[model samples]
Target: MASDLNIARHGPQDGPPILLIHGAWHGAWCWDGLAPLLAAAGFRVLAPDLRGHGESPGRKHLRWTGIRQHVRDISALITGLDQPPIVIAHSMGGFIAQHLMARGVPMRGVAMLAALPHTGALPIALKTLWHHPRTFARILTRLSLYPMVADPADAARLFLDPATPAPEANRFHAKLQDESFRAFLDMVALALPGKPARPYPALVLAGADDALFPPKAEQRLARRLATTAQVLPGAPHDLMLSPHTETTARHILDWAATLPPGAKPPATAQTAPQT
Candidate 1:
């Protein structure tokens, strides 16, 4: 059965819980150092590897599954939590967070870090990378890529900070693999809601140099929500592993501090869904 695939974790036992979902080509391991930092700020943290990522089982061969399934998997886990925890999503995980709360919800808030709002339009670079023959062959071969692109150096530059201690990015890259195509399909299919969509008290962050979620998507989402969005200038896609990782984490902690309680229902923001 599909479920939230968990990875490493560290934080307070009884403090407010923050559910962290990672992006494509990454797992909860990406949150390794950040989890403890957040925990020090007094929060319980759950960092789960999305299915078919990290050490999770490969869903590549499955008959049929998509982003909706991933969101449902995440929602089911949150429902079982002692409280409706705040969601800390990165990249693709941010998309999941929004989908989770498209309708009113019992969520605290969403902190979307370097995330994609809707899968409708990712950058041309990402589309090229995903569709490349070498990359496509890797996906076709094992429904994974870690083994195929075992370049720790490139992984560090593209996905983590070149300044990050060698081990962090190396270890993460060694664990990389093919993600389920269903997930990408679902991301592209995320139709805006018909009823007024939920106004997630969300934080849409971006790395100035983030080639994936460039300035365009970030500001657009912020403008749509009419909330201030923060951009980490000079940072790359691996903003977490870069020098600003700690700073970014601190910023999120500070923002989450001002959030309303988890029981309050989500507010409506987006316009009516198409017929």
Candidate 2:
């Protein structure tokens, strides 16, 4: 059975709605710093924990769940909203967002932060591990075997900027939950070619210092999605929790303002992509 997603809503009720989707090993809590900033900027933000992550149930079946299950969860949330929201998705969440778009989910716009490619995270992971063998070996070993929880140092190396405060990094690391191995594989297996081209505007943003998805990959992904890529200097993969959180939120808000007014869809039924 699927678990109910726990959603955290912020900002005024009358503001334009924005849906924030976190990546693997992260939950709605990942948007803690970014959501309020976007909210204060006059957007209503809704961040939801994917099944088996954070406070959501179904952890015991995480290994059995894949991208299809997660897509179902998010599809339900979008359908329940009063309007098609501007989606700001990070890493694996970006992958989910793309699937949603391919399924023809209407939206005001989408902002992808260090998003994984349609081809998936495997190549990125291999490259990252090859570059920083010792550090990633420890992290990947535990991740492949345990699939839940991670070492703070490993998390810092993978997600944090070099100048990130140790305290903040530790706190963020502590909040991470176990990711689904099946979901990771599913992300790798999914491709974008056969899916219908999305008509909605998309902003592809990446961190210059992101080891996982480098600038080249980001640009390539933008090309694949028919959009230009934007890079943030000195930023890491986890931009939301980094010092650049406010800047990222502001950029998203600004981009959203530039979108066509009629892009926002009225409340409508949403159907999940056939798995």
Candidate 3:
């Protein structure tokens, strides 16, 4: 199944590779707007629907799948590439990227957008439970992640900026699928990733108006990575989506220009074991 990931490839074959990782409940479709922009900027972009989301097949196993499995899937993809690709990871995907770094996976660089904090997502979970008791109850009863964004209003509030049109928000909500419940547990307590043993060029960008993880959480993540956070004003949790995608892409393009030219994959890099 490792070879069966639904990956959307774009741009020139010989261009520098840029791997785009979507967050929880989202899939490669979430990168629709941002991928084209990155490809146009001369990047060979690859966006994969992590198992159980989007076109990728794993629905039956989603309930048991965790973050470590997702990381292994990505590690395989990187191993197959001609050169180590720069990774652009968002939200939960950021955690996966951090895990790769911790395990000594080679990469040209990493840009984390609206990433979960190293301290874990317990605070976000508690805040959601306090603010949306009914929804939280549904999540608890069903043992599912969908309840949190089942309503279009809730989805818009959590992931989109207020400036986004209602129709667009509804469409985005419709596309959301159930995330791995086990992965949620891993993020909360079971397997919070630590700082990487080896350093690489890193950037953290967050939405100023994100309802989930706040700017301060992203700032903390940046500090751990030995970098500074850049908060995009009016942006929300889904940075690759509407209103601020171009702005997000511009920041990434600017950062990509600064990476060392012709960097080679490290000998220490190793492919993760297949699940």
Candidate 3 residue lDDT tens string, 32-113: 9999999998999999999888888888999889999898889888877878899999999998898888877778899999
Candidate 1 residue spans exceeding 4 A from truth: 1-4, 7-9, 57-64, 119-122, 125-154, 164-168, 190-196, 263-275
Best by lDDT: 3
Candidate 1 differs from the real structure by a C-alpha RMSD in angstroms, to one decimal, of 4.8
205 Cα displacement, candidate 1 (Å): 1.3
The best-first sequence of candidates by TM-score reads 3, 2, 1
- Selected candidate, larger TM-score, 1 vs 2: 2
What is the C-alpha lDDT profile of model 1 across 1-275, one tens digit per residue?
23546556677777888888888767887787788888888888888877666666545543244566666667767666677788888877877776676744346878878777653533533564665657546544654434324567756655665567877666777766555555655555644322215666777778888866776788876666557679887877755664777988978888898997555223433212212
Candidate 2: where is the Cα deviation over 4 Å? 1-3, 128-149, 190-196, 262-268, 272-275
Global lDDT scores for all candidate models: 0.67, 0.78, 0.88
TM-score of decoy 2: 0.88
Total backbone clashes of model 3? 0
Q: How much lDDT does candidate 3 score?
A: 0.88
What's the true lDDT of residue 95 in model 3?
Answer: 88
Candidate 1 lDDT (Cα, 0 to 1) = 0.67
Overlapping backbone residue pairs in candidate 2 total: 1
